[model samples]
Target chain A: MVDVRYETAFTLYPYARSADQDADSPARHPVVIVGGGPVGMGMALELGLKDVPCVVLDDHDGVGVGSRAICFAKRTLEICDRMGAADPMVDLGVVWNVGRVFRDERQIYDFNLLPEEGHKRPAFINLQQPYFEKFLVERIRAAQAEGAPIEIRGKNRVLSTESYDDHVALEIDTPEGPYKIEADYLVACDGARSAVRSMLGHDFTGRVFEDNFLICDVKMTADFPTERWFWFDPPFNRGQSVLLHKQPDDIWRIDFQLGWDIDRKAVVQPEYYMPKVQAMLGEGVEFEPEWVSVYTFQCMSMDEYRHGRVFFAGDSAHQVSPFGARGCNGGIQDVDNLGWKLAAVIKGEAGERLLDTYQEERKHGADENILNSSRTTDFMTPKTEIAKLFRESVLDLVEHTDAMRPLVNSGRLSLPCVYDGSSLNGADDAILPQRTRVGATLADAPTDQGWLIDRIGGRFQLFTVNTDFKPEGLNLDLVDVIVAPDDLITERYLGAAEQAVYLIRPDQVIAARWVNPTAADVTAALNTAMGG
Target chain B: MEKLFTANIDDADGFYAELLAAHEGLSEAESYALNARLVLLLSNVVGDRAVLTRAFELAKQAG
Candidate 1:
């Protein structure tokens, strides 16, 4: 039997005093978030902002060293801005709008992602994950300083947990000792080998790439342009791919494609990767390797994001290949998603039913990310021999075809993600359907990147032109309407813009759109999104 | 379709028009400023009583 009194796990925040309640009912938190990585940390910040107490548990001594997830999408940066880390982050990382692809030393193609800065932030900024974590940890600490009940406990490992009717009893192995803690909700932001997810019997089933890659951070010497550059068939290595990106602190994170045949046990040294670098830099370049790790990309998806009160965010919920910057950014999106919803639920402003929408929205996003990352990875390194040849041919013709330019260059990298179907999505086929052209578009706004409900539309948008029917005299507070002034919206969207007004959610996803937009429809959408 | 949307303040026709401006081209600074104007406009449209009522409901619900 496990001991109940000893609390050994990492406890950054204070636990409820024995004086407050009975021995077992100590005041720790209503929510316990597992894993102390970016997603976990983001959730803690969100909870802290909401005045919801949370405890983050991690077994690692600290954030992982070395460069990983060098690309940060605009959405992730926006969330970091929300947490007050973006300003500093912008200072630390290089904002890249252009990317150049290579086939050996020859520059095959290049592309730009700053599609006129359509939305809030740039398409991406390249930064080291370690430094990014440092900034994130700082914000988390600040939140704690503000008397937000969020704590970070390192070396506090989670062994297992048991969930009953109202709470989950956790059995964590703290550095000090083992402890039994109970929480109203437990979210696992743990990585792919999530013990929490495994304990709940959720399976992460998907494809794993056979091609191995050596990820190395090195100093650059050659006069390569300062854009994210990739080489499909670098002459230095026959039938291998190379991705070179500029990272913060003047380091370059390079990915060298190594076929699966390489020994996994082989140690990573400057020699193993230097040849690739030397191959590209024929002469007059001196660079030293900083850190090197050989990793294989995998695209795996969780069966579900929520199982009862236990929610999984980030890699715990899903794993996307590193391509398209989906791995970390997608997880951050999950944090943004669950953060506000959790506050709404815990505060009782939103119905418990809103909890169900998390799976619907995040799962759809994770799946799309997996698809995008997988597709991009496929283009980068084709497994089949014929596919490899076809990819090579495509790269050869990148000089031609505006249509083929983005195809081979793969705008898939920093392109924003679209949610095809979401409960939070109103009458549109998906949330932010205007931004997503896979199906229909929003009514009023006409922008290529799509319309944000909160920006152009009024706050608490009503989304109706009829203004005629207040029928039941529904309160219009925080509400606005959307009326297509003329053919502008319809033409750009290219059809599928038919509908009355659609009440967009705060996050810009259409909460609901009505064909006729009766008072009942408006009230129903508000009720569904807000739990009226 | 009878659409219900606030005209982006950046638009030449603040709240009405046959043409929709290419709002994407505007800088982030410009867009957020316009958003603030639209929020206050919406607040006015919501009216004082509705605002108080909805705020009270949200507060009560949160409590």
Candidate 2:
């Protein structure tokens, strides 16, 4: 029996002949993205929004089957909102902000991820990966209709790539035949089993866990709340862990941690794993399985994300255990950091040295994700008896006292990265709010025009709050916002200061902030931000 | 910002006796678990990461 729901939801960018196929020489593009996954499409969308020409090539015509990468963090949603692709996702996704941890049959503690009340999106949304890719492709189509120079070629796979001083040449295989194309910058978002990474002979260096986890997406009409439920040493799966999450439809994602020495092939069979699910869900619940797969993850990344004219993003650059929901979130941030700089350099606005900041900032983000995921993996599947002892002790202490609750490590959850001490950062006022300091991503606040995040990005901006101080002759937009006396915009961006000014990057990261500054200060900060 | 090796405990021998008594009647595994919990609690009490890092180095060198 076949389930039609798990099939390709949208046949976006089907195989079509291009002028490059018939040309005697390879057609060159500003950027060529080698994967139609979320990260690849996201990179294209980011460039397309900046009026940069980009081409996306993928082997498949549509989204892959299965409910993979279900958790999209708030930072990812903010990025998508900037790209005009987040509306449908937020509408179709199961929004969740609370997570509950369990031990045996008892609920240890619960946490609200977004305790503050100012942000536009929830802390996280549980939408299947297929829906994520479909939304991105839909946004691309909309951009194309509006005259964005973005092209996607489906059933087109890059067979090999060669790097030169100025461009990268790729041999791509399509259903029709093989064709060649050249790109000034080639981005490889080809996922963990990346052929491009293999072609370059670069390897990810880190630890690989021996334990396997089985994910079962079951469709059942039940009353499970849209909150993440995680268990440690549950009765049904003793000495192991379990995770239950609610998706958009009636589909529920349940992950069972099979021990180290289990047959990977046999465990995914419905005959073997269904009994475990039935035991967990109790008997007499009518349910059908939607998708099932076994996976083992590694917490690893390459030493550098950029290689000459070729760059790696997402799982191709780094792979982490799915404990913290950092996989796609980190990848989205990678392209967000790269897209603007690449566009600026290609447009002759900034020096090529600006692109090196992508490697610097995103490698730090990747390492942070890897470190958190590795800690969670070690806690969940302890390698030594002493490690297990400590884990059990933490779990035991959580049941009785609130002091040890913070020690629980189901997953740290994902947060936006602050590029502290980066070369790109400009002057930062010490008295301003620390959360909105220079090198930090701008926090969303309410303004006269809808959300503050929606009004910024796509270009550098001088964002001012509470005062109408504008500097003339600068090559950037000035967004002067006057809010109520006690609004979150004032509290978040200004702390005890009568006026605040921020020099925001194209990616919405704060380059510099000042309580009071001269026009010369603004010009110097803007020049420093542009790699002057 | 004080160093961790400073003499802080007034009665070191009395505190050592209390620590040994906390693990009196238990198996080897239980003793290890108790020691682990005690280390965690004491580390929380001394919450400075720099101090804990220095303490870790001192303990590791002693072992």
Alpha-carbon runs more than 4 Å astray in model 1: A1-28, A221-224, A399-403, A409-411, A414-416, A427-433, A436-502, A513-521, B1-63
Query: Pick by TM-score: which candidate is best?
Result: 2
Give iRMSD, candidate 2: 14.6
Q: Pick the candidate with the highest DockQ.
A: 2
Candidate 2 residues lying further than 4 Å off, grouped into runs, are: A1-9, B1-63
Each prediction's DockQ? 0.01, 0.05
Predicted candidate 1 versus true structure: per-residue lDDT over A1-532, tens digit per residue: 2123323223333332222223455344689999877788888887887788888877764567677778887767766765677777778888776878777567755667555533445667888877777787788788778888887766667777887767888876754566667789889999888989888788889999988888878876555667877777678767777777888766888787888889765738655667777666565578888778888878888888988889999998889878778888889888877887887788787887788888887887888788677767766666554445445655554443233353462426544455555555544432223543321223234344344322332124554442444536776643333435354444333235454455655444456654455677677767766644
The deviation in Å at residue B3 for candidate 1 is 37
DockQ of 2: 0.05
**Docking quality tier of candidate 2?**
incorrect
Q: What is the TM-score of chain A alone in each candidate?
A: 0.83, 0.97
